[model samples]
Target: MSQKNNKKRPKSRSWRGLFRRRSDPHRAYREKYLETLQYQHRTFDVKGLTTQGIFTLELARVFVDLGLGQMGQRPSTDPIPRFAPAQQRERHSIWEYLTSESLQNHNLAVLGAPGSGKTTLLKHLTLTLASPESLPESVQGMPRMPILLLLRDYAAIIEEEPDFSLLTAVKQELARREENIPLDWLAQDLQNGRCLIMLDGLDEVAKPQLRRQVVAWVERQMQLYRNNRFIITSRPFGYRNNPLNGVLVLEVRPFTPEQVRQFIHNWYLANEIKSAGHDDKGVRLDARQGAEDLLVRLRQTPVLLDMSVNPLLLTMIATVHRYRSSLPGRRVELYEEICEVFLGKRHEARGILYDLTPAQKKRVLQPLAYAMMLHKQREISIEEAMAIIDEPLSRVSPHTPRNEFLRMIENTSGLLVEREVGMLGFAHLTFQEYLTAVHVLDQRLEHELVQHI
Candidate 1:
């Protein structure tokens, strides 16, 4: 009887082992999904331009120290000791400080103006956490998965489901990314403090009501997912009310002269490698000359320096300077030149010709710009954008098909971008503002204001 029982036990165990060996479709899908995500989001898509650069966040972040108090001031609870060690007084990257803390109770709000490298910093952080090899010494060996959620996308989700939550939104995002991760697995990871949530672009929420909801949702997420780390980003004005509680607010500092110089050097060095041929020496020489010229301009002109301190503008300056061999003297002139470059000259220089002239394109875009400004919108639907082009298209070129014209504008014009499917926004907020300013001036609003004053 004992021998028979033992034999039955072995058979049952073998059957169970065989069942386990069978392939799990869900598990297989998850493994492939992770690989795909690692391939897709492992690097920053610099400037959202076809001419992209691969830069680590460590290189992009300016090391500015902050005291943990109100609006970057000294902490209320403590005073600095006069004889404190030099190391304690030294500056550190916000990234370093953030990792050093007990994140279970900590949340961070990173505020910066448009084109101020906020997104870039977030991207760097995501990539670093996502890719273990890129992790800093302090965060190394930590078991965590970084999930990056564009708040604009999250706001849209909340609109669809009034009862939506941060975790649900994250699950939706993972699904969109084609990741087949199970909710149980995600919940386990979150509960174990193995997740870093990076919520980017709170400012991109176009509506105030929607933005406020997003803020509330974020604050709730911090409480609910108390074990995990969280970082939220926004433009300064967008976060004026200080919505998130128990949060450290850190502002991204403008690039200093030395940092700017280093950036230029790195930019040229990276680009020169791509442009190099058999004569590498000539490419290097030209790159050095370009960097030197840009540095000289930044040093000599305060206005130019002011513009160059922001990474987006500086990158554009570098891009324009690389191709054009000169920068416009005035700020408006620079924008105008940039507009023209995007409209026609950039394509022409690349030996591609679009049918629309720069003037015709400008006429078509001006009314759209004006509408966006009047409505206080940063993004527009494709249908609305086409309607905007229709009025100008009729006046400038009556024969132009609206669809064809819109396609051409999107393809050749660097000024406009398709932020998501069926949606569009200016390449940068600054471009939108510049175009809106031009529209206002053209309408004689400046003269009317002066008269009223």
Candidate 2:
């Protein structure tokens, strides 16, 4: 009986072992319920089946397994090009200016007409300043790495605020690069002399109020970073208030005849070489010769030298010169045609002064007539013109804002350039002749009418 009892006890123990703990139906059900809740939470109904829900479940599982959800992501934009001073020397003289001892105290103002390589020069300068090798020996004592903030990009980032703090904007920009290398640490390494902030395109920023604010901010930044240099480029008139009034202003003169000739020759040679490498050898050689001859002809004009050698301009020049047989005459005709095209068909006899609104027409005629007379006599500045017209600029075409008026003139066949502040001048003497011809044509028309009557 004892042996049977022992055997039963052992059998009972073994059975308990086999069963382990009772599978709690409640707990199991609870777990399943929670899992169903999770599935529901993660899932979405797609036409009766939760495909998106399933995808979410899978993704969640993957994310959970990888432990990767904590890190944030941002939409990517084009990376800023690292500065390379040596390579950009072809485009910007600012590199030379900055490196030179003479320009140390000089605050530069690079002025150029639109598409006159101002942006390219500024971009090159930005890149150069950003490069490691270009860092001045003195900057090694400073604490932060120099930051280049495209004011436009900065404005976009801080859209809520109408008034932006340049210092704060700069700090935020530097913080963004923290992942790369700590700017504070970099600045510490340079002993606070590390950063050279470059603000580009003061003229392109659309709002006048913002421009004024930015200019003030820039002035503050200049004051804050006395060791650092600020370089700016803009079209004339935009800086009428002369934000950097006391700072040394160095203008970017148009490319010299030699510079232009070299650019054209080099461009032609590059094309010739590129064409020759292609399968059509005869065509390439002929093109090369033709380009060389064209380059010779283009070098004769100072204006043509500065202007980009685009196909459209080239074709227009070719057509005009081919018909006229004289470069000067061709240039004059081209300018006139451009004015006519922009001002309308009647511009040659009637003048653009006629196209202005009644009030504007009245305000402009006397000033324009005086400008024409001065232009006929010799080159004159807008300031000089204002003096000749004997009226405040506000009184002259009050309806048309200054920049728009200048743009109107600029777009009118590209002959007139806003040369400097309060200066409107022809791109070349030939263009001046064209304007004079418009005046002459008007006078002749009047004379003929009087005689006919």
Candidate 3:
């Protein structure tokens, strides 16, 4: 038996000089807060591959540090505009430039299309900042307390508490670990130019009025914490109306063929290393061979290869290809397979059941997607969404409660996403477009669609 085993779960951690911007008077609480951030951001949560026996991958092990550039000026989802390939010289490696002094000195807004790795980049920065040992050159001697916040959470908080400021949010974030931190600790840090403020997913704010408030709030914080580093992320369209002044806009460039190859190699190698649980020589040759096979398949198929540039979709392709050993050549077939992977395969793997079948899940969501496209809204409130989905649900799942269907769809299917409190939307814009087109064709709404066009 073990020796009395009394470790009491675990605290965050103890790190030497993690945020060396200055000495902390409240060392205990500060370290605890930093540890929490480190734990939360230090892993890549890859989904839909549980059957492959990989649920979480280490952030440091597989992170590829995809470059940033002026990939495109618009957020349009058209292939050319959204995913313009970047030449080597035109982009800056995230490994080299992410925490460079020049970037740290100025505020920045990183915009990218859906699944283009904007959030991943922020999380990478968070994880590295949390653990400076991982990025010695990138973050050493320039450590700032990495305060990462999701803008959606910010919006939700402020809506309930009108007096909630960024300062309050940070304090609350720390307080959640414990209330031992002095009230002046964060303020002193902010005053002394010692914080890296990262706000992620501006597009997820959903409501326009609340978005305006969030932007204004950010602007206010930038002014108040004039010396601290700030980085905000969003899709290009979400930021077009109220673009911040003096903040550099860097678009997340898609993975070029070379980067794609590197990511594939890294992903497989990392998985093999994790599965084998050792680093002995020849522990796993499967990673090297499997990466080659996946790369070959992508190289042979133009559409799949083109889709490989986007990191999230490419990751899905890699996971799905590994399990299935083949890829659908057509974009439509690929989308259908993605839906099946998310809606059916995921739940099947977990032995979970729902009232609606995979096809019926799509059936209920098609009209909602059609309505969203018709009105030019990517997200709808839960009430409005339930109302729109009511008719479709009645047709497919009359016995199922609407809220129960919504809950199952959110939990099991993974196609419907809640961007924020009381808000719902499709996980991807491409999914919405495909479902909307299906709806139009099935209902013979060509004339109505043509009129709108």
Candidate 2 wrong stretches, greater than 4 Å: 1-93, 101-107, 113-116, 127-191, 205-209, 270-291, 299-398, 401-429, 432-453
Number of clashes in every candidate structure? 0, 16, 0
lDDT of each: 0.61, 0.42, 0.69
**Which window of ten consecutive residues has the lowest lDDT sum in model 3?**
1-10
Candidate 2 lDDT by residue in tens digits, 1-453 = 001111110001121221233563333332332233233223211121111111211112111000001001211010111223432243434545454444444445554433344444443333333333444563332222334456655544344564566555645654554422222333332233434455666654445676676676667667655555566665444454445753544444334334434444434444444445543667556655655566666766655543433222332344344334456434655654434433333232222223353333223333454355454533456555545434433665555554555444543324445535456655445445455445546555445324533
Model 3 TM-score relative to the real fold: 0.68
Among these predictions, the greatest lDDT belongs to 3
Query: How much is the lDDT of residue 75 in candidate 1?
Result: 14
lDDT of 2 at 341: 36
| Preferred candidate (lDDT higher): 1 or 2 | 1
**Against the true structure, candidate 1 has what lDDT?**
0.61
Show where candidate 3 strays beyond 4 Å: 1-25, 47-53, 71-73, 76-89, 94-104, 133-135, 141-143, 160-162, 174-184, 328-334, 337-453
Name the TM-score of candidate 1.
0.59
lDDT (tens digit, per residue) of candidate 3 on 1-453 = 011322221121223453454565676556666677877778765544433435467777777777776434443332222243344456876544435544445677887755677777888878766654454643553436778988876787776765677778877776665644554666766777677789987766756688887888888888888777788998665687768876777777667778889889888888778878876567457888889988988888765676787776687788777665556544565677667655665434434344567788888888989999999988888888889889889998788778777755664444676657788777668778889988999999999888888
Q: Which regions of candidate 1 are displaced past 4 Å?
A: 1-38, 42-91, 102-104, 141-143, 165-167, 178-184, 277-286, 328-333, 337-453
